[model samples]
Target: MSSATVDTPEGGFEFIVHDDHHHDDGEHHHETGTMLGFWIYLMSDCLIFGILFAIYAVVGQNYAAGPAPVDLFELDKIAWATAWLLLSSITYGFSVIKMHENNKNMMMFWLLVTGIFGAAFLYLSVEEFMHLWHIGAGPGASAFLSAFWFLVGTHGVHVACGALWLVVLLVQVQIHGLTHENKRRILCLSLFWHFLDLIWIGVFSFVYLTGVLL
Candidate 1:
């Protein structure tokens, strides 16, 4: 009689069946490890933002050029900007659900929508900055302006980065299908996208709205 040995990649035992049965230990451990590593990386990123936010809070009101946030920001435009980011986050949620279902086209479509909305938000935000700059309230004008620039610019940079990442992930998904690694990448990107939305909500209420109305 001859014996058959199964490979586990790291050189280990695998279950073999006499019938036409297939069994492989799912890469659940690898998936879990990837998720944990992603979370740790995200938390470390969060700490860096936490410091920036604290600095903004401390020096956020120093408007040396006589142009306060209320004077420079327009609520209607800010509202539209907020809607854009919120929509992008919702679209990304759809993408993740579709990814879980292994519906590649649906996932890609939703991700495209997400990226479009994200880009729109960035466009609107840049327009808003331009509007402010035209009114003589650019970054160098005041500490208040500087803080605003620092905070809002930080978030915009993040959005741009996220959009770029979505492009990369879209390509990866196209190449790999809904693989374990690809799925983990999607999961991490989803988290990053939603986290940006959460922070933008803070930016809207505390930064834009308060600066405008209060």
Candidate 2:
């Protein structure tokens, strides 16, 4: 008889499963290790964002006698985009809850809803960027515009990546059902999605809101 080590889905231990349908003592350490590695990756991302924020703080006022944030930013439009992003995070939470319940259909439904909201956010953000470019308030216009676009545009790219990942995950779940690997992938993506939401909060506060107010 042959045996292989497999991590259990719910805990921090690994167990051995045999070819002949026999199981033995083990623990689920793999999942825990994976989560820790992901946390480290997220910390690295934090460092990147921190650098961008510092750069923006330094150069955000150097408008080169060009348009400032107040002249370019439409607060109402940004507010609506923010609403869509926040709502997407909430819907992703619902999907996670459904995953925990092992309700695949409801989970997929909520995940799809989340994707829609994310798409709406991206649409509004792109529209805002297009408007700015059309009005000659683009990144090359000034140091202020450069920093603004770099920071916000980087975040927008991340959101776009996440949205794409969501679509791939949806198709994976549909084809494979809620297997253990699928569930683990979902959990990872959940963390990623919520992390984006938190970062967006910082962007909204430090960049958009303050850009308008101060």
Candidate 3:
């Protein structure tokens, strides 16, 4: 139902109109604002990552007689982790497509696949970090290690949170079906998941590849 205000010779009155669906002005505005607010939050995240990258660029080579990237970074493992993250992004895209098609089961299935890929990426990353620590090339070893750990670890934490959020969303969708609010939440998460993929590409190229190759 929708109500509209009208003015006539009898002053002002409001009437409620019965309808199959509601399209209240306030509800539409709220949905629009949700996306706009999420975009602003993403911009803030970009700034944070930008500052981290700048810090790494400045301190990445200050090895201080410690293990360098070539000595500590195993490109084979990094490559595998990169593949997992990239695959997760692709799966997430498929999930969004299913979402738009209104196939809740397929959408949830793709989301679960994406979460698995994300977990694999995190597992590889943690194993690499453990190997580095065991070899005495941990973050405290040098300026270079510090910057590398901070930049990469921050991204890892973000991925962890995203995976957890995905799980919660799955439950919510299962309970609530594909309501408008749930759809909006899915879109917000899609942006966030894709944004993480973009940031990881920069990390792989700038931090991993550049450190090892250059």
Candidate 4:
């Protein structure tokens, strides 16, 4: 029996072929690497937040002749902002479900709803900051206010970024439908949105609620 042969650098040799299964394995590895990298990034972010929280804990009571949390923090407003953010997480979850179902329209609608809720959260947060500024409670006024603004403002910025990301993803979904790449993107966004919600819960409990009590 004759067999196929190929030329090597030095001589001819029998050709050896492998199945295409390794290609699928390589792709799976790539996907896992992507998720792992994102997770590592999130952990670094947690460290940043942890340091901020530690700083706040150290100087959160230094009023420097300024208003304290009791005077400046509004529970009602915080509650509303929390509700909006939490609801946005829920809507994002729905969007992910719709994506899994391959229902592009429903996914887009849920993403829009999530964005609106995120916007509401950011608006409420900005309003609270503005009210503080108008009342002479700006970050420069005291260490406590500075820490408060830095921590809360950082979270607000993240939400704003997430909202923008959602908009871009929505446009991509419209243009490309829910391709495998898009689904992966949506899943990553879902992780990020839920992570924010978890962080906000911590903010509400540790910052807002605890501040009011203190």
Number of the predicted model whose TM-score against the real structure is largest:
2
- Looking at candidate 1, what is the lDDT of residue 184? 68
Regions of candidate 4 where Cα sits further than 4 Å from its true position: 1-30
lDDT of 4 by residue, 1-214 (tens): 2223322322112211221222346323335544677788878888878888888899998989878888888899899998998899888899988887889999999999999999999899989989989989988999998998998888888888888999999998898788656776788788888888888887898889999888
Q: Global lDDT of each model?
A: 0.78, 0.85, 0.85, 0.81
* Residue 24 in model 2: lDDT: 34
Cα RMSDs of all predictions? 6.4, 4.9, 7.6, 8.7
Taking all chains together, the TM-score of candidate 4 against the true structure is: 0.86
Model 1 lDDT per residue over 11-119, tens place = 1222122111322445334344456777888788678677767777887887764887777778888888888988988899999889878899999999999999999
List clashing residue pairs in candidate 4.
none
Worst 10 residues of 3 by lDDT: 11-20
Query: Candidate 2: lDDT over CA atoms?
Result: 0.85
The clash count of every prediction, one per candidate, is 1, 6, 0, 0
- List pairs with backbone clashes in candidate 2: 12-28, 13-27, 13-28, 14-26, 14-27, 14-28
Model 3, range 1-214, lDDT digits (tens) per residue?
2333322212112212311133454233435556788989989999999999999999999999988888777888889999999999999999989988899999999999999999999999888888888989888999999999999999999999999999999998998887666777888998999999999999999998899876
TM-score, prediction 2:
0.87
